[model samples]
Target chain A: MKVKIKSNAFLIAVSAVILGLLAGGLLMMSIGSNPFEGFYYLFRGGLMNMERIGNTISTAITLMLVGLSVAFAFKTGLFNIGAAGQMLVGGLCATLVAHYVFIPRPFYLVVIIFCAFLGGALWGVIPGILKAKFNVHEVVATIMMNWIAYWSIYYFVPAYLKGPSLETESKSIAIGQTLRSPWLTGIFGGGYINLGIFVAIAAVFVIKYVLDKTTLGFELKAVGSNRFCAEYAGIKVNRNVVISMMIAGGLAGLAGMAYYTGYSRNIQIGVMPSMGFDGIAVALLGASNPIGVLFSALFFGMLQSGKGFMNAMTEVPPEIADTIIATIIYFTATSVLFSRFWDSVGRRKRDKAQQKSDQDESKEEVSHE
Target chain B: MNNTTTKQSLFTSPLGIAIYIVVGLVLLAVMATNHLIGMILPYAIAYTIPLLMTALGGLYSERSGVTNLGLEGLMLVGYFASALTINLTEQTLQASALPLGLLAGVLAGALFSMLHAFASINLKADQVISGTAINMLASALTVYLARTIAGSGNVRIMLGIVRRDIPGLSKIPGIGTLFFTQSYWSTWVALIVWGASWFLLYKTSFGLRLRACGEHPSAVASAGVNVYGMRYFGVGMSGALAGLGGSIILITYSGEFNGTVAGLGFLSIAALIFGQWKPLGILGATFFFGTATTIANVSQVIPQLGVIPPVIFKVFPYVVTLLALIVFSKRSAAPKAVGEAF
Candidate 1:
């Protein structure tokens, strides 16, 4: 029973991925393209060469951090829908620091990253306080925060950080100010992949260690599993909620730093990064597990990066790729339902086997008597 | 002495009195400052109609125990369906085809919402996740279909142009100019729907059962009511209303269906919470939000307000929404079992 329960989430995630791909294939077929060939081109687009592979990892860096943010919050039974808002604030802060702060390269990098994390944490903390103190729904609060962040960026970017010609985005950061180290770029054969990947990887290990080995993680998980029960067990539920959200926000803030300073290198106005929402999908697909999130983020990264190639190689439109991604997310979101269904089937089989064994034992006892 | 005591009681009940006084002051200020504010009133009402309908739709779903965050997506689907219908039938049926287009949009919205219903209801999936999926799917599918059918990512409805006045109503002194002049017939439809929704939710047996399901599904189930059925009904009604709202926006306001519905759906949800899940409260919330939005749009054209940053005006409505939520959220009474699987 223990083993089955342990593997349940993994099984559901794997099946969801398969189902998502199959659905995508069906969609490809409907568009009059061969599914196999379409998938082939998609994979080729993401992994055709060293440059492509590096690009895929580069894309995954932000997703990885965002995914971790979501998964961490999920463990504490909080839905941080405001990750996008958090990312925006984090990115904005990092952008400000990157443009204005003059220091040694290492110190500047540290200061910018720290500021980004604090910005995201601030965004996360508000919703947390609202939820903990007032019992206001986090979902609604986070969504509201998202718009607030969006409009703030919209106002701040054009007013202060206007680029050369575009009124919609901020000025690009200098290369020396970015998270891109020359050694890392050189290792990836001159790909855009940067130090953000290392940060994401480091985050995964830290999060895993904290979740699996620390009392704080246990307490948070306990609160998540049953708030009332956790309270009865002397856990400060409100504190845990606030802490969980702060950590989650911090992770998302780092994602913003990675994206604005490392990936895109500038913030755009009038647009919320879709990566924030995509993180939810990544977390769901990963079953909210750190290791699972890492793998799923990479998979999603491939699909996103490979999509352009698929569009170019096939007669299929670019929108189909988005549709496919949405379909995958839809399937992943329903994985809990599938997991429950699978568990019931397993339970029924176990019950039948136990009944048969008991009958055989009863018959042998009667014969011995 | 009795009249004075009554006035004192009104003062004690500050919120109601405060709202009236603030509204009066704002109106007086607007009249003194610019006549353009008066012109924006009709436009504000037009904008409010869609939001009002969408919030009403959200109330139905949430009151029936399903957390429907997909109101925006449902609205978009409705918008796309109506726009596509209008586009396809414009040459043959001309202006007369709009009703059909509206019906198509409602049907499409209801049909799309079924996916959400199935996931959150039968599958007992996480309601938020299911709603998010619906949103993602709706945008992606609509954009894909629009591109395929129209050879572009946007669907433009060209046949039904709504810019007219109601015959006798447009002649009324101040009221006519604010409410009837240059209004879409959809405005009247929205008002009628609002009245009908109030009656259905507050005065009907089905509404009682639906609300019961949201609050205490097990209790309703013990009373031999099908909890699932009532939830489905609530979700279905929500879809229908959202669909209508989407159609109204397309025909009256935007005239084009893009892959997005701005953020009106999210704003409606904010209004839903702000209104404390009540019909009358929702109406007030929508009006306030609509006016704020109208002010934002009008600020760009008004020379005096031009001195202020344009982005501040654009951000004004959202900021107000956040403040409203923060103020009202704690006191607002939501259905107890919202986001819970039956």
Candidate 2:
């Protein structure tokens, strides 16, 4: 029964992906473009060479972490819409540590990473507390927090971390201060890939372990499924809510570290990270599972990285590519409908089997008579 | 003695004369300090109208039990539709293009919101996810279509209407300066809509059933009203108002569609919450937020307010919104069955 349920989830996810792709194809055809060629270039652009592959992985690194953050919050029945705010604060903190704290490379990196986690956790906990104590809708509070973080960065970057000419972003961090280790870069043949990819992979396993093998995970899942039932089972629902948000915030913060330090090497002002919201699509497509998130993030990473190349190759504009991605997200968001359809199919098959068994029993009884 | 007694009673009432006195004094101080304050007030009013209209839209949807977080997206779709219509028909429709464009916007917004209603009501999808998807689709589709059709990513309309004074009303003292002068016609339309919304929501039988559905769908269903239909109606109304709000902004303020609404839709949701889903409360909240936003833009004209960083002025409204949500949310009684699938 358990295996059947697991397979059902897998089937639903696969079908959703296929349907989403079909929709995207239809959209392409509507725009008078060859969907097949568009997809071909899209894949080629993402995996044409080692350098491109490394860039794709680099892009996936942030996505994987953010996806995990969102999936983790889902496990606890909390919608962490404040991931963008958390990312901003996290990236800002890491940037600050990277600039001021000059120590041994390993120690500085560890300190900076920890600071990023704490910053994200701090931003996340505000909404958690508001939800727990004040009954404030986390959605509204988190959205408000996003704007606050956005403007705060706008204020902070120009005043303290202003680059030489660009007023919109901070000065780039030196290589030693960044997450880009020489060894990793060397293996990627001078690609943009960095140590953050490894961190993201490790996070997937760590999150999986924590969720599957811990009492805390059990309690959080219980609360998510039914808060009243969890409370009746002697779980502290409010504390779990706060703890889940903090952990989710911490994961997103790590993503911020990867993005600002590893990929871009600088923090930008006024722009909320689109990856924060895209993480929702990733989480949904992955069915909110850590391992699933890893694969889905890789897929999305390919789409995003390949979009520019696809635009260059085909008459299809970049905006159309965005529409395609949004279409996929729209389909994935309605995954509940797909599950219901699958459930009905399963039920129908079971009903047919039961009827066949009954007919065979009746025939045997008549033969004995 | 009788006159003093009457004055004392007025002061002691909850809607007290003292409150008006305080407001009057603050206005007097602002006008005395900077005459530009009077000029900014009209702009604030103009800005507040769209927000107020959008909030009213949110009120209808939420009251009927479906959370319409796609207001921002709906607004964008409406804005794009209206802008395109106006831009294409400018040569033929001329001055008549404004009303025709608005009608197109309302229809487009309603049609777009039907996608949301279908997913949330029939498919029983997560409302927030559905809303987010709508937002993504709106921005992406609008930009894509705009690029393909217009050969540019923005749709610019040529029908820039001149602001008209309301004849004798514009000559009144401080009131005329703050309310009547330099106001767009859309402002009056928005006010009329707000009054109509108040009447419909409070005085109509349909409103009672809609509110009941939000609070308890089973009870509403038991009473022989279609819960799903009511939800659809609520969401459709929200979309129409949001569309009108978007059209108003394009016609009166921006004079173009840019595939974005600057998060005004979300701000309207904030206003809805701040107002506790009441029409009058929404009006007051919109004005407060409108004033807050206008201050950020008008700071350049008021030299005395220019010293503080412009970012602070920009951030102030958001900060105030956050604070307001935190303080009022606990006391605010939202519909019990909101965000739940019927």
User: What's the TM-score of chain B for every model shown?
Assistant: 0.91, 0.90
Rate residue A281 of model 1 by lDDT.
Answer: 79
What's the distance in Å from true for residue B239, model 2?
1.5
Provide TM-scores for the models: 0.92, 0.92
Cα lDDT of model 2 by residue, B73-94, tens digit? 8999989999999999989979
lDDT of 1 by residue, B43-136 (tens): 8888899999999999999999999999988999999999999999988998887988899988998888888888889877778877887887
Q: Per-residue lDDT for A165 in model 2?
A: 86
> lDDT (0-100) at residue A174 of candidate 2?
88
Instruction: List residue ranges in candidate 1 displaced over 4 A.
Output: A1-7, A344-369, B1-28
Best by lDDT: 1
User: Weakest 10 consecutive residues, lDDT, candidate 1 chain B?
Assistant: B1-10
Interface RMSD value for candidate 1, one decimal?
A: 4.9
- The alpha-carbon deviation from the true structure for residue B333 of candidate 2, after best TM-score superposition, in angstroms, is 2.0
Give every collision pair in model 1. Answer: none
> Which regions of candidate 2 deviate over 4 angstroms?
A1-7, A351-369, B1-34
- List lDDT for all candidates, in order: 0.84, 0.83
- Which residue pairs collide in model 2, if any? none
